[model samples]
Target: MSQTVFCRKYQQELEALPFPPLPGEKGQEIQRTVSKQAWEEWQAQQTRLINEKHLNLLDPQTREYLMEQMERFFDNRETDQAEGYVPPSR
Candidate 1:
């Protein structure tokens, strides 16, 4: 069975990631606190931000900006959105 974590984003028990998404303390922290569903949503948002903003990942500032956005996202705080992007109607 998959491990479950008290998701920091969803604020309830949910399926946890099988492994750390990054190296070091932050990855471990996320593995312990963030749900897999939340991580997947963040990845989709990150892709949209990168594509819409034409962000260059090679730039350190761009990486930092994305990281800040990720934190805000997980914390349920106000975060930047890709301009002119619309979600599909369900």
Candidate 2:
């Protein structure tokens, strides 16, 4: 069975990531607190932000900005959205 964690974003027990998404303490923290579902959603949003804003991952500033956005996303705080993008209706 997959591991489970008390997701910080959802405030409930949910499936945890199999491994850290990045290297270092921040990644470990996320592995311990974030749910897989939440992480996946963040990935989709991150891709949207990159495509819409033309972000360059090689740039330190862009990486920092994305990190900040990731934290806000997991914290359930206000986060930036891609302009002119619409969510598909369920």
Report the poorest 10 consecutive residues by lDDT, candidate 2. Answer: 1-10
Query: Which pairs of residues collide in candidate 1?
Result: none
The models' CA-based lDDT, in order, is 0.96, 0.97
Tens-digit lDDT track of model 2 for 1-90:
988999999999999999999999989999999999999999999999999999999999999999999999999999999999899999
Error in Å for residue 32 of model 1? 0.8
Q: How many clashing pairs in candidate 2?
A: 0
Q: In candidate 2, which residue pairs get closer than 3 Å at backbone N, Cα or C atoms, i.e. clash?
A: none
RMSD of each: 0.8, 0.7
Report the lDDT tens digits of candidate 1 across residue range 1-90: 998999999999999999999899999999999999999999999999999999999999999999999999999998899998888899
The stretch of ten residues in a row with the least summed lDDT in candidate 1 is: 79-88
